[model samples]
Target: MIVPIPPGERTYRAQQAFEFAGSDLAGLVLFDDQLIQYFTGFIFIPTERPIALIITREGERILFVPRLEYEHALETAQVEEVRSYPEFPGEQHPLLFLSEHLQQLGLRRGLIGVDHDGYPPVMGYSGPALSELFAIRRVSAALDRQMALKSEPELSLIRESARWAGHAHRLLQQYTRPGLSESEVEARATREATQAMQAEMGPGFRSHNRWISGAVALYRGQIGPNSALPHAISINAVFKAGDNLVTGASAGVWGYLSELERTMFVGEPTPQQRHYFRHMLELQDLALEHMRPGRACADVDRVVRAYYEREGLLPYWRHHVGHSLGQRIHESPFLDIGEQAVLEPGMVFSIEPGLYVPGLGGFRHSDTVLITSRGAELLTHYPRELEALIIPA
Candidate 1:
């Protein structure tokens, strides 16, 4: 269900959106309760309900929620008006109600901006309805352009989230050893993430269960080369000595998340594993160095490709450099060819350079970074240092 946001938070977000759009106000429609819940940092609870929002140019906001959720939305939302629709047989559909409300606000025409991508078609009535009632023109790029830059508060949330992820990684490092099942390590990591969030951010934060695993072999019943990918599911693979372990630790603080992963050797890494890990780290650094203001995103890809080709590692560069990150795990400003958007300050993205050698598993180092006027700010702080996680052969 859509819980109402505090008026202060609503004002802050609305004002930020207005500034980002370079306009008086941008109308945002939070049609899905789940989206609203996550973006608003509300707890995820299942509900067969829909919600709508109208943020005005002057910072006044309104919410349209189902009758059952009216009180909850009122309490949780930051908007001034918390209107409700009865269970059934209402005078008008929710869309029409919203249209009327917007019309009443005297926003039926003239430079009203919206985020078509954020407000999917399924979430609200088609543009035709809105267009019929108001002079609506699609300002498709408005929200994404605004969201590209992270404000201080947004960066604070991301930094805190990264801290929790670091804590989770530490827990994984301590618990993982030879003879332990992949599921066991995953369980411990999940527990650590959950506990860390609860303690750090209180009840509003929750960690999703996820982990990763892989290996070489064991000798003398000790931990072996371990290679663990951050797996969100159970893995039956057994850990052994000399195996390489790669794991990603991710934790959500409020609705924000920070992810960091490392490659560790159960005992000592083989020459091949160490080489691959080093290359992956280098690629990560290369991607970060190439990120700058006004550089074409496609140019970023060219630099990565050139580096990989120079090292005779082109075939291993499976994915693009990175993608934008925000309320959604992956958003726009993709680091690839054909993306024309110039790099701007306040944009945040992941520069995850990866290499997947067939039959050898995959090696990827990902970090969420904010593009600043100076350069990129790395959000994840966990050490990427390659080390041997000795388990005593």
Candidate 2:
């Protein structure tokens, strides 16, 4: 049996959600697969089939899932009350069950807090407007804020995922060679990393226990021109002497994730490539240097963006320094020009700064990090020095 989240912690999250939803809100409805997992610690790969969690301010919860998921829900959910529908396009609407459950809870009429973005597609949920039964208020932003702060358990999962990915990077470096294909190296690294984590974390250590393996995102290396495109999939580029390569990978331990990447040379780098590589490393350092508890997230991006602009290198810039990482991979409080949120302790982010010049190959490095009261704590530590990353051919 999976170790469940403490009942007190679950209650705390519900109380916090209610606080976010406001005391006037009679209840909160959760349909997003991730949010449901957050509350119940139950893992279910979302499909078109709908699943809902009806949670009231009084700390009452009724998990309504597809009948096929009933047994699984019973096995994983901490809540004693578990309910389900026959399936999609069932004889009875899913909302009808929700309404019945709500009525039983004596929440017949009042305001309801709901994640509008978490709702199933209208076509998938053709029931009467929940607004008809109760006044509806979109609390998606509130939910985002509530989930933004990393709990201790969440931090541990993320930190472990970082360690898992870091080990994968080591494996990828071992397999990387002048003749091996990008896919081959990535495959080897992913397999090795997955096995290592499974052995280390143990069978019962699963946080999300996803079928995609702990190295879900896997380690991928892009060579030469493909590397220059920033997000392009490797075209099976054969490693060649002096060719610049961007090796990046993410590990998924349970659902939490961490990113790790390094720009390397097959043998020796050209003066141009070496120059840009050093700049990329410096830019990453600048972002990390600026990460502190009270710093505005965008300021980090701005200071670095100014550096690129001053160097007349803004043309090669592609994206922000980094973004918040959690189970979702990409979350809010991004380190970009538009983000104004102040950094807080326990908020995790990726410090990925890149200079991708066409024809010159991409020079980028990324790492998972946590913001601390003093500064940012680096989690994905491998070697960053250009000389250290060279794959001797």
- lDDT values for all models: 0.62, 0.78
Range of the 10 consecutive residues with the lowest summed lDDT in candidate 1: 212-221
Question: What C-alpha lDDT, on a 0 to 100 scale, does residue 147 get in candidate 1?
Answer: 57
The most accurate candidate by TM-score is: 2
Prediction 1 global C-alpha lDDT: 0.62
- Model 2: lDDT equals 0.78
User: Candidate 2 — worst ten consecutive residues by lDDT sum?
Assistant: 211-220
Q: Which residue segments of model 1 deviate by more than 4 Å?
A: 1-9, 19-48, 88-92, 109-112, 117-135, 200-236, 241-244, 388-393
Q: lDDT tens digits, residues 209-311, model 2?
A: 4433566323244587678887776587677787888877666665577778888888888889988988998899989889999899989999999999988
Query: How much does candidate 2 score in TM-score?
Result: 0.92
Cα displacement (angstroms), candidate 1, residue 357, comes to 1.4
| Model 2 misplaced regions, further than 4 Å | 1-7, 122-129, 207-212, 216-221
